[model samples]
Target: MTATTTVTTTATTSAAAAVTGVGVVLPGLNEPGGLRHGPVAGADPVDPAALIGKKGLRFKDRATQLGLCMAAAALTDAGLLGPRGLLVPGDRVGVVVSSNLGNADTVCRAVATIAEENTGALSPMDTPNASSNIIASEIAIRFGLRGPNLTVCNGVTSGLDALRWARLTLRSGRADHMVVAGVEPDNDVTRRLTGARMVDGGAAVVVSRTDAAGAAAPRVLLGPSFRTEKLPDCVAALADAVPGPAREAAAGLWLGPDPSAVPPGGETADLSGWGDCSGALGLLHCATAVAWADSGRTEPVYALLGGAGGEASGTVWIPVERAA
Candidate 1:
């Protein structure tokens, strides 16, 4: 399909501070079942057996496990514990997750069951988890979220699309708090489908309305989407608009060749890995920005995310604010 661009921002940021929490979930692959600390921008390789134990989670698929793990981590990052029971009961909380290849394991198992049994009878367990909505459904059930729930599968822009949709829902007064996540599991099928070049991982972020002047809130900045075909070109545009220091501290440039090669006026702090999961890359950028802001540095932060369809998408800037 030919790529297209759509831009929408809410002029009204006064809807009871819509989102109060965010969560991310990732799956364990092989070894080192956690985030790796390095200059690479991609996810750390994880051994499923080590992280979840051999018999601990035999029934769940890789994506489901990843989704749950990231969701729990995001809740902790947002300083919330089981937000379903809290967060102004009945105050609409939405869950939006992005995945390009959804539930490959379940699909494979279902097909296998049919072949082995030599009949149309499919495994009941395999059928439910096979849908792309499984991750969204699991998130809803785990957190008791009863608002709008959606699963986006837009090539590489799924994560950013999910965030954009969640923000729109909040601004439209559809929900109060939304949990948006980008998750991908490692499987032979997904690897072949998406041209697997990096390990599997997931990340999530909570976007909510905050008073511009609130002392305890995260630095919130909004700008038009950066549209471009090349990563370096987009970074240059953002650098010109945002301050230099902020650009320097960018956790990682999502696109482009080398950080050092950036023009004289455009110097990025460091180069994280590249092209882990296209859907989750935007969330990873946001998460990195938050980490830098939390470090007490006064520099501005910008996250640049682009998709394979020659589409450039990113937030212009975000400032740090202490929560009230």
Candidate 2:
């Protein structure tokens, strides 16, 4: 199905982007079960344990497990049993994943082994896992996604950049289906390099063209032509432009109180994670969406990404009818 793509900028909304579905997954870690202040009056708190794997297979590395788990979770959340039956053998499926430091644990171990004076030859089996594309390649192999598969490492903006590429590819008919993923694994090097406050997680979303005739459509909505600036400026602009209720709601998720309660340009969410692996923040955003599903809220999700080059990109997604 071809979509009448539109890119508009106005005082009310920046742009209109499109998305079919989204899914989020996080690694098992010790964390508080509820939000800092507990659930909203009528809303229930999301159980972090239910979204992660407590125990499982041994051979898979942390990155691989994170990527796979997020992919599966996204598919399940989109109500797709399996793509094998739905997608044709030759159908174009694309994957765009972002990570800042890929497999630091494996690389460290390999280096350590070589440093050992009496250590034997380095393990050939461990080499491939050290590659940055390891996680992306694994997903492609498992899902048979043969279209454009890209791995971007642009710091915190990595995830948002991946999503932008996927959106454009689908709109241009480069791929009929696309999976955009953001994943990171916990490692001593990463912890030390970016400090120990960062969180490790993964999130993936299956985006496809909306079926015009379908009865049940995806709830996520996207917008085109996103604008992004520095963190402070972006926050200020959003605060001024977004409706009071929406701003309040988003602030409640990222901050302890409503956005209006704080200074207009102050940071809301804990962005320390961005310093370590900003790409993983995409997963956190996905998790927030999943947790907010019960609220019956309908709004286009705006993803803003900032990187080392002072480059920033914004993208939006809109929910549409699901395919059978």
Candidate 3:
């Protein structure tokens, strides 16, 4: 039996952040057809060196490299990046990353080296990656995002939580745009720690205030409702939060592992086939929804996330044409 969530709702109904662009570096997504057909087996694994070159990647962690690929694609899609640099001012943009095991391999290696050998043996090039915030900082530094930079590692909710942080940052006028990426690389350390197969790449979205977004950009609303409760009750709260007719018009996207947790709806997409994306699942869910809406789906979509730890979060995607 699934645990019940408290029906308390804590939603931020401020101006919705516009999802202007999407970037995916996951299995089968970077290929010709993209995620329109879902993850394919035997898909080409991500090659960051080939995608972004090798000049600055010698010591960077896998997660960071994947993040650059994802973020750069999204930013380029959004028309924010140019040959010279960011089209928008660097200080007007920020980065938020959600990854539970991004730097785990590096940290573990450093610790083992210190214990077995000595601190003197630590490679200077690998020292920066030992920090937990390296992935977010690296993306920001690489892209010249001088605005608020944050990283989330809060279990299952981390991915959605990173999106939440971006929304909040935009609402607070701290930045005009935010690049959000959720990445997790599969390595011996992460596999042993999580005990599940992992996806070696990530997905990203470029979100900005509706007014700040370009006129031709595709737009989707992130949320006016966010909650933490049991899967069932969390869905109930989200359904109740939307007005009568609007709630009826939305479909569902399940981002969790449990199929039974899917809320009753018109149509629902189970995204578990991407494998154990860990904290990156939330961002992946949102990015996929945006892509679908842009593909001419008229009905609004709800991306639902419920973790094993009883944390539940949801986001509403309102297509640009339907948003009014």
lDDT of 2 at 122: 72
Stretches of candidate 1 off by over 4 Å are 1-58, 82-87, 112-119, 211-216, 219-264, 269-275, 307-309, 321-324
Q: What is the C-alpha lDDT profile of model 1 across 109-161, one tens digit per residue?
A: 67787888954587565577888798888877766778899998876556666
| Residue 90 CA displacement from its true place in model 2, Å | 5.7
Query: lDDT of all the models against the reference?
Result: 0.56, 0.54, 0.77
lDDT of 3 by residue, 152-222 (tens): 99877788778888988988999989999999998899999989878888788888887784423656776
Best by lDDT: 3
Q: Please rank every candidate by lDDT, starting with the best.
A: 3, 1, 2
Show model 2 residue runs off by greater than 4 Å: 1-18, 27-59, 79-90, 115-120, 211-216, 225-229, 232-277, 290-294, 299-301, 307-309, 317-324
TM-score of each: 0.72, 0.68, 0.90
Error of 3 at 80 (Å): 0.3
Of candidate 1, the 10-residue stretch with the lowest lDDT total is 27-36
lDDT (Cα, tens digit) per residue for candidate 2, span 196-252: 634455567766555422112445544443345444444334444445454443332
